[model samples]
Target: MAEQADHADRADRAGHADRAGHADHPAYPVGLRLHGRRVVVVGGGQVAQRRLPQLIATGAVITLISPSATPSVEAMADAGEIRWEHRRYQDGDLADTWYALIASSDTTANDAASAEAERTRTWCVRADDAEAATAWTPATGRSENVTVAVLTTTSQGRDPRHSAAIRDAIVEGLRDGTLAAPHHRTRAPGVALVGGGPGDPDLITVRGRRLLAEADVVIADRLGPRDLLDELPPHVEVIDAAKIPYGRFMAQEAINQALIEHAKAGKSVVRLKGGDPFVFGRGMEEAQALAAEGIPCTVVPGISSTISVPGAAGIPVTHRGVAHEFTVVSGHVAPEDPRSLVDWEAVARMRGTLVLLMAVDKIGAIAAALIAHGKDPATPVALVQEGTTAAQRRVDATLADVGERAVAEDVRPPAVIVIGDVVAVGPHSAPTTGQDRPGDQQ
Candidate 1:
């Protein structure tokens, strides 16, 4: 009898603490089916701009009442996604409205519109005052087909940042298969051309990582974030599709044939390449080849080393008052080679930054051509090798001696060559030995 009495007392104390933690009654959460219903948004500022897309997605007949709106809101109105009254809120705007959002800059107008919503017995959300709002918008995110919504309130009040953090955690977990729910599995058979970003596994995009997590087969390149393959499930077939330059390598035609065969066999295929597939990565060629075979292809863009590698080495491709234009070109062929399509003379005529990829082997001839075509012989140059990876390093030199410097440092392929005054513009312009770490110099 005494133990039962103690349990009852403890339960009463827990209930009391729960009630004391909230300043107002706990809000009951519900998903409103708002399709074909009248929804009015008062104001057209950042708050309204942020909320409009979700409201628009509900298929509600939305009417936006404001004298002025941000450019994005104006675009929505122009696109006919919503009807814009081009006027301020009046008393009767909430009549027959099923739901309303009050986010105008004018507090008096917000108060008036919210009061009208109250009188009409319609639910309304107030961006200015959550205490007075009849409805609260939850922090929402979508992962795969699952929608995660979180609404959290502290002893003080609504903690939106906390709610957002929770939402992000849930969404990331679901996306990467960390949550491991049955409904979140991906079984679709198609090809996804994913850009693995510039050598850093962490730099790969969320979409790319999610696709990798779902892939039954991953055809990987030698240059991209190869570490990502180690994280795949044991059942996933990781094909070594490395295209080594001037060595044992798989031909492009063979790679295309392999992708077709695997996809035709009903396995989900991901052609993971280094950097963006479209940016000189021969991604469009594979895309075209897949199209010929009637295979569905999804291209996910990655961060290209053309810009990111230089950035990783503390060099902005373009700086204010320094360089207005930065040109990126492939330097696999010497400038004098008939097979080369790049107009090296025109490139040298421009007074801007020049970024070269696959040019380590031909740097001597390329630099001589640039100097001969009016480019300054003493123009600064920095080569970032294995950029964004642990082995990344920077080799600095001038255009006149970059060829000699490349030989002295023994710079190899897979290095990005940045040429121009912009290399000398940053705090990291100091020369370094080849052993300098990327984080230390970049």
Candidate 2:
């Protein structure tokens, strides 16, 4: 029995060793390249159109074959940007091509092209069927001296949509100075968790904006606002974490891991996020992760949308006599879960105001919950969309009607909802009749 026990222990140790070995494997292979190559694209629709510009920028000699072409492609062909066959792909279309793209709408043509390219020992990209290709286009990106390629291969190729998204993120990161080359003069790496401010780029703190200008690598989410990115230098490095409205995202764990990995590689990393990183931006989590890794990091706060958004819409949470205080809550959290740790009853009864972030989607339910918890149904509320920007708009109503009004007005995300009597003090409020009564009339 003792011999058997020893054997089991040995097996367990071997298993753990094998697992560790697997875990040490890299997430992806590196150093893929496709510069100044001859390539062919088999279609001319929107997808083909999308790939053309990127291919041209990579200095690839692209030959497009299609029965019909989009106006953009035709214009490019006219301008000598690319060669267009203006005919359906022939059997020998893949011949003499270093790389071929099978983007034809017909599946049979795509298959034939793939087979032909394989026979010629040339690389083929099956635009739609990535798995069948000899090589797949990853989300190819270049920021300063940093090049990024994201690929998902399940013993196969990749998904085109996912690849495109990854590429776009990289481009954004680059343009925003989020992806920059490290200072070769210094090997020490530092990190900055910068708040991107509210919707307006002007609201970004001076320090935060300066850091953005100096960023060697920037990793930001969709909410970081486009105007801020527009301010980045041309050679900056930028990366997108794939956080889009109502879309799947790169897990926060993965994002944190990426940030640390890049910083440890001796690159100045900037984790740019919307609004103040401490105001429910999950900046704390990222900071903790960096601390545990012993990486130097600093937090630069921005104007939190929690207060600025409401204020931008001309609604004050606290007034001299109207409201003595205010409460801020995350609409992104569950109202029913106790661990959400929100004191709904206290907030409802407090002689103050309430401001909600990321609660637009659950407005109706939240309003109902608040009323049920003893908050007045008649409390004035204002939904401010794209606050502090040229696109700013507000929908005002009572707590009981604000959600419905928001929907009716088509108020979208990136909005803040303010609930309190202060909303009634805005310029749009009913004018006092006393002042206009007699001699004031023109």
Candidate 3:
């Protein structure tokens, strides 16, 4: 009997070697049009739960055969997404089936069903044994109009994690404009006001990145994720709306005219700015300008730095019991500036948190006004400079001495100032020199 068992083990190894040696007969990749066609899944366990959603999406006529199933699979049956036979697999289960997946826990049932699929010349996948299966599933992903599928034809080289990693890489490249397929897509002529998010290229919205990938012309600001510009195709034109070659920034009127002219000339235009286009970004001005010229405009919201910046430095604008409300105010102009629209006195009187953007230069006067109006001079303040970028740092101070700290610490513009007790609630509330903080990656 031991000799017979040794012989069987040798035969099994020989079978595996035979399959591995037939490299020329590798699986030929083809996408099945399973819509309205019969498909059978012989298991309702974890495998079925994971693979059913993609099958149902194909609009195929699916029938699942199993005595029991996971709750999620049962839910799919209850929702009429699939027909569940609540019985053990029978010999004729694969009859008239276009494709079959044999994944039942019972080895005997799986073998029978796989044999039926083979006898009927139907393509089948055996989860228990890939070598015995006639077909294999590829790691798939969709980016816009593109569908990516990665497969390893050789059984010896098969690795699901490797295939999934390749799929993710390709999809991410397609979404981020690194892999531009301009020849395959028809470009539409219009203006898209896309907020590029704080300073990180990855922070940009997927929609914003997709629009950028399809753009014929991009009018970019200096503040946002400028690194993305280096990824644009050579045929695409990038206009520096923030600065010109002559040491002067382009005027708002000129920028508006640029958008209108490019769009009218039958080019896809993207006005990529930092932060949300609607939050003090003059996005409405651009939208109104486009409307006046009858140009179509699409606004894509972005992650605003007003909240994200402080959060990156471990500050929450609103903490339970610390502050119930937070107000975002632009500090481009000093509190005493004639053109300033913010009522500093009224703002100081509010008991909630105060978040000031573009306020590094004017924080001193602003702090003094807040103190005089009724805010506590000793209220904790945090200045996050170049927030969410490689150069990000935090400066801790109070309303009474933030002005001096700003100058002494060489704090620059593009800093977010946070005031109120919420500043003291964060873990990074401890005092630190103006240097790169932890987790301040690009």
Measured by TM-score, the strongest candidate is 1
List per-prediction Cα lDDT, in the order shown. Answer: 0.89, 0.79, 0.88
TM-score of each: 0.83, 0.55, 0.74
Per-residue C-alpha lDDT of model 3 across residues 196-289, encoded as one tens digit per residue: 9988888999879988988989999887789889877898899988843235798989999999999999999999999899987889999999
Return the top candidate by lDDT. Answer: 1
Would you list the rank order by TM-score, best first? 1, 3, 2
lDDT of model 2 at position 231: 65
lDDT of 3 at 137: 86
Better of 1 and 3 by TM-score: 1
Residue 48 lDDT, candidate 2, scale 0-100: 84
- Candidate 2 per-residue lDDT over residues 1-442, each given as its tens digit: 9999898888768745753554343234544244766788999988788778877877788899998999998998999989998888789887768877678798988888888886676877777775566666667766545577777644333355787797877666555546554455764687899998887877877667667878678898766756777667677678887565688787899989988998998887888898898998889999999999999999988889888888888887776556767888888766786667787777888767888988888888788888989988999899999898899999888988877887899988888999988888766766444323355432
TM-score of 2: 0.55
Model 1, 1-442: lDDT tens digits are 9999898788768745754554656678889899999999999999989999999998999999999999999999999999999999999999899999999999999999988886677999999987677788999999867789998653256789989999999999777655556535556677999999999998988888888888889999999799888888899999888877798888899999999999999899999999999988999999999999999999999999999999999999986556778999999999999999999989999888999999998999999999999999999999999999999999999999999999999898799999998899777555434443455433
Best first by lDDT, ranked: 1, 3, 2
lDDT of 2 at 275: 88
RMSD of each: 9.3, 21.7, 8.6
